[model samples]
Target: MFDYQIKDNCLSNKNILITGAGDGIGRQAALTYAKLGATVILLGKTVKKLEAVYDEIMALGAPEPAIIPLDLKGATKQNYVDMAATIAEQVGQLDGALLNASMLGELNPFTQIHEQIWQDVMQVNVTSQFLLAQALIPTMLNAKNASLVFTSSGVGNKGRAFWGAYSISKFATEGMMQVIADEYDSSTLRCNAINPGATETKMRASAYPAEDKSKLASPEDIMPLYVYLMSDDSIGETGKTLKAQ
Candidate 1:
């Protein structure tokens, strides 16, 4: 399905929310969705970066995007509920959501990790995603069909030494996707996780500082799967973990 050709307006009239929309794959997904005719909600911690994406979308003559600055680490369940209410009031209903915001607390031995670091990683990666999905599921169900995509890593599906809390959090992510997918298997709401292996981004640079950057694919290069999942092409596909290389 990733290799399939997508129509120009495959996502027309859709309202999609993308967390971490300021940079990397999240940014590229927001831009691509907007260009394909979806009204994207750019959610990230940096207002300036979100504004830049909003400007670029307008400049490209795509649908004007909305900006929502949110820091997942400090966001509470009530905050997520409020955000969901706001989306319902303004956007009517959400056709899709890309839970792309995450943090790499540190890559160290599990036995040597600190409590605060583990908590921070879990809050941003696992807890925040849970709360966000819990709030958005109702709105998503309102649409004729909806897609929920979670960002995963190679280490997420398998244990890797020194990955520590980040790896553990990703495992939780995969589990969450599976549970949700199973619950909605008989419904029009589909959920899946995408593993973007070795993408060229700041996170990758931090994780592998000595590696050659040219060998890695850019975030924009792995967007075919992103577009495929968000559009109607992957309607019956759920609970699957896909890789983008």
Candidate 2:
């Protein structure tokens, strides 16, 4: 349970960019990072949602957070490249980046997976993440020690039945993470993946409508691992999947 001290200023001079930060785990992570003294960049498709998150970070009197409204599902390489250039210009070098955005396509048998659903899920969950990481690599490498985390799932590590494109995308995500980690492990850039097991969030509710939510941990409860991974405490760590409480 939060092995680290979680110093009031753990992220004291860092800037962290989090995607899918409008809600769920991403939102919680943003708020936590802000409170811990990092300037947060909130990214999501919905401007209002990102605004709300920005307001929350501001209310805490933490750092002045920035909002980026862009849908990953339809984003292109140029879009990510432009975003990276802007971040480099504004924040200099990004100290941390969490690839928390994802799309849950039709969760059905592979044989029944819709063609559009497969493409859409891969766009957001895999392709977009790749492009974003590619764009931000330079910025991240510029940091003293930067951490890159990809949101992964249990089904990703092992192919499961009826999980369809979502699982496959996560698997790709994990592989992407390893590739980055292996290539940059000796450098300032470290890459890893997180499997926020059974967190209580809207996406989880949607995926498990019949299950009892009370049995799952809240997003807040899982921040310890997230915060740890984002900070210097885990500097030597890379190319592994972390499980959140």
Candidate 3:
């Protein structure tokens, strides 16, 4: 069921990093990139799940993927810097970075948004991305070209009564992408965000437990847009938000 006509080996010789890659869309994207011939770096909190993706990619004879266990909620700026340094030592230069890690927080009314919960959500869903991107851009700039894709939500563009922190975090995500994109407009680096509408993932299940999952598209269904954004094919295209249907 996982397939994209973007072709095999389109990312050959490139190195891409994806956060929250242990499961959900991040996991599928990592696998897709591996199959497309990119040396995929899987970053997440779960080592076991990362190993599962690593094995799956290796089984396909794709590049032996790398894994970094990181908890976005608690990770410090130094942690991100250290992570980038390690990637630089081993990978030389980065071809792409996908900031797919995010926390849904709680779906509640605006006035019911607790300060602690809001802070936690912003830390994982926004601050961490800022720090991670700040750390990794050097590796990307070192390459001939690079792409940075942040994951967004429908509620991010429009406020929802019960969406709370998750929605606010995504708005920041969009702003972050725009700022970064403008910073490197004259350079080889590009930044953008993707709103993968309703997808079959744990986050989706959590958000819509009453909804039928079989009715929604799988994360794998959006691989085309993912691959396109990461590949050189999308060169010169940056800063715009894309909706993956």
Candidate 2, superposed: residue stretches over 4 Å from native: 1-3
Look at candidate 2 and tell me the lDDT of residue 130: 92
Per-model CA lDDT versus the true structure:
0.93, 0.92, 0.92
Tens digit of per-residue lDDT, candidate 2, span 117-225: 9999999999999999999999999999999999999988999899989999999999999999999978999999999988888888888889898888999988988
Q: What TM-score, to 2 decimals, does candidate 2 have? A: 0.98
Candidate 1 lDDT tens digits, 1-245 = 24667689899999999999999989999999998999999999999999999999999999889998999999999999999999999988899999998899898998988899999999999999999999999999999999999989999989999999999999999999999999999998999999988888889989999999998898888888998989998999999999876
| lDDT score for residue 22 of model 1 | 99
TM-score of each: 0.98, 0.98, 0.97
Tens digits of lDDT, candidate 3, 1-245: 22336976899999999999999999999999999899999999999999999999999999899999999999999999999999999989999999998999888889999999999999999999999999999999999989999999888889988998999899999999999999999999999899988999998899899998889989889889899899988899899888887
Clashing pairs in 2: none
